[model samples]
Target: MFTTKIIAVILCCLLVSSNGLQPSTCSNQGDGNYGCFDIASQGSCTEVSNQPASRDIRWPHSGIDSNIDWAIKCGDIIAYKIQWFSGGWSGWYVPGVNDMDTKVNNGNGLRRMWSYFYDHTHSYIICKTNDSNKLRGCQ
Candidate 1:
């Protein structure tokens, strides 16, 4: 059993390396910067319906079992998070309210990110990681 576990770990490590799956750490992250789930920094967005920079409104995926290879991990919540990788790992966020409001924060929330960034729909621009950093759309 121990041997099998060791082999599994080795294989996993090998796969991670061969598959470009980076092994990042928050150590390099500067001080005072929020960690993966910095719920405190989630201040507010001047406007929720902010326009999208990346024209591809169908990219920068979310949820598990998705096109994980091409997608970069952005922010994460409890059950899941948005994918927005950057070589290894640029870092992560805790994600804030869907919309800056005391009432329309749920499904009513705008499918945009902080400011006018572009986060697909899962969260918002706080987690944009599309190809070539396309922020204009199918232009």
Candidate 2:
């Protein structure tokens, strides 16, 4: 009876572990690179390459739309279409702009920072790649 009980307990543990109990998120490449879904289909690579390199500024804002909000919470990679400082070529979206900006602004600060920009930038979207947390399912 004792042996049977032990076996049963072991089986239960295995079952629990196999069900992906921990919070896991999927990746874009399937190798678990990014937390947000793959936006490759939406031309992420092209968009990133075409963006002009510029000095990006970090600004904090709140109450961003849902699409941007989701990415900030769970995205792995950041991409952006940066506009140059000069006139014209003013609006475009960047994938990881918020993440990058946040990192730069914080700069080893002790305070915990929450991403707040979602509306100030135009056409910016967050790609939801798979993460170990499994929060988002296959898209």
Candidate 3:
């Protein structure tokens, strides 16, 4: 049983890393109020506002997903496009891994990020969610 559990965990981790899909800083926290998602510089590359890691939580009015809001990296155009296409996530998300598909609810965040790489491959991206929650947005 121990071995099986270990193997299962390893497989899960493998699947998650298969596409370099980094999980959210805070795993599916109900509403950022409890713990807002923070965008990072390593993975899910995002736009920056004033200083590094000092982006405003209120970018626009609010993401279309519920009351969840998205704080784009200051002026990252790709970030804006991704959010525009995916409706902006209050937290980090990946398609074909954590998310069921990459066509619904804007599951292309990871894909777009990964595909946006100069060589069509990115190490990671940064996504920060202030008052966003509800995993229903993805798989």
In the range 40-124, model 1's lDDT, one tens digit per residue, is 5343232122233443423322222223212332322212223333313212333343322233334454332221123422232
- Cα RMSD of all models vs. native, in order, equals 17.1, 13.1, 20.0
Return the top candidate by TM-score. Answer: 2
| lDDT, candidate 2, 1-139, per-residue tens | 9999999999999998877433356545544454655444442211223323222222243222324334334442234443333433434433334333334433454211223222222223345543443346333
Per model, how many backbone clashes are there? 13, 23, 15
* TM-score per candidate, chains pooled: 0.17, 0.22, 0.16
- Among all windows of ten consecutive residues in candidate 1, which has the lowest summed lDDT? 60-69
Write the candidate numbers in order of decreasing lDDT: 2, 1, 3
Native-to-model Cα distance after best TM-score fit, residue 10 in candidate 3, in Å: 41
